[model samples]
Target: MKITRRIHSCVEISDGDTTVVLDPGGFGTPDNLAEVDAVLITHIHPDHVDADALTAARATNPELRIYGPEGLRELIDADYNVVADGDTFSLGSLNVEVRETPHEKIINSKELPENLGYLFNDTVLHPGDSMAAIPDMEVVLVPISGPWLRMLMVDEYLAAHRPKRFIGVHDGVDNDNGLTLRGGLLRQLAKDHGVEYLPLKPGESVEV
Candidate 1:
């Protein structure tokens, strides 16, 4: 399988033929939802699941199957298969396992967002905005930029989880100098934890 890094939370994964797009949100344009075999949204947040984009994609590809948290259906009127934690589904030969993880606490008063992580082909795990315990995976799309995150947590998360491959995401917020400096820091950090960090810019794909 190959994972193509998009601008932010959005990522496109395909096994040569069929593709599964994850979190086609506000940071980057996912071109068309019709292109992907399916879409696995992590949450209802616009940054993770842009409703306008999906709605537009569906207009052209009505057969496109969308899967995500059950509550998002109310917010997004689409033909969706609501899924819960630990639920498993398959698209042709592709296998997906849902992991319901608690979103990191950003505020003491506000409730955590319902975040869902996807384990694809038992190899890659894309955790939207959650920094919780990640299941064992060969590669992980680590969120390196967000208001709710810090570099310290990025260091600790990789050190603790220790996936074989580290792919950075959620980095749409970084500026030119910020990306260069932070990219170097993150790459070295991943190496320190014995993980190969691919500095994949937006629209770049890496075969895994």
Candidate 2:
């Protein structure tokens, strides 16, 4: 499978024939939006679910399927499939398992939204905005920086899950310096836990 990292938490995964985009939000739309077969949303946050982009995509590709938690219906203006914990489905050759993880609490904010992690073909896990525990998977898309996150929390997450490999996501907030500092620390942390840390800049693609 080919994995392409987009800005913030957005990621595109393809198995040659089928292309699925996840979290095409405020950061940016997938480069191949017109060809996207499906879109999986982890939450309703604008940075993770760009309503304008999705609306345009839907207009352009009438067959494109969008899946997300139930609450997403109220936030989005376009039609989408509602999915909750334990749901399983397929997009061409890729099989997806939906696991609900509560959005991390942000101090002084209103109630948190529902977050769902997507496990792809039983190999990769995209845990959205949460660092919640999940079943064993070969690769994990870890959220490295955000308002509800800290270095210590990220360290704990890596130690707890210990996937064979991890790539940072939800990192649009960081400048080059901040990204370098965080990436350096995470690389060492992953090494300490016997996990390989693969860092990809926006628009970069890696095969797994």
Candidate 3:
């Protein structure tokens, strides 16, 4: 599979026959959605779910399948599949398993019930904004930094999961403070854990 990092947590995964777009927000404009068969949204944050971009993509491709965590269905007008913890679904050749994420408790809003992480094709795991225990996968998309995710939690997640390859996401852009410190920390952690950690710049692609 070929993984293209658009920006932030947004990525496009193409396995020749099918293309799965994850977190099609932030740097994802309408033009970026071309030829996309499906979109998987991890959360409802604006940085992760730009309404205009998603709406345009859905409008352009009416057959597109949109998937998101629970409570997101009511927020979107498009035909969507709402998934919760332990839900399994498919998009063409890709099989996805949704895992529940603990709420960060930024506010007392009931709207933020649970977060989601996705195991795709059983080979890649995209842990939205949640810390995850490592599963058997060639590549793991790890959230190195975020408003709610702490540095220690990131360290623990990496050490625990220990995937063969790790790509730092949800940081290193847009003046996020953690990004500034995480680059060095991840490098050091990579050495300590004996895993390959890749810090990708925006608009870059990595093959897995």
User: What local lDDT does model 1 show for residue 207?
Assistant: 92
- Give me the overall lDDT of model 1: 0.84
- Residue 54 lDDT, candidate 3, scale 0-100: 81
lDDT of 3 at 102: 72
Write down the lDDT of every candidate, Cα atoms only: 0.84, 0.88, 0.76
In model 3, the Cα lDDT at residue 101 comes to 75
- Per-residue lDDT over 87-115 for candidate 3, one digit per residue giving the tens place of the 0 to 100 score: 99877777889987775655565456457
Q: Candidate 3: which stretches are off by over 4 Å? A: 26-30, 107-111, 172-180
In model 3, how large is the Cα lDDT of residue 191?
A: 88
* lDDT of model 3 at position 19: 88
Residue 105 alpha-carbon offset, candidate 2, angstroms: 0.8
TM-score, each model? 0.94, 0.96, 0.87
Q: Cα deviation of 166 in candidate 1 (Å)?
A: 0.7
Runs in model 1 lying further than 4 Å from the true structure: none
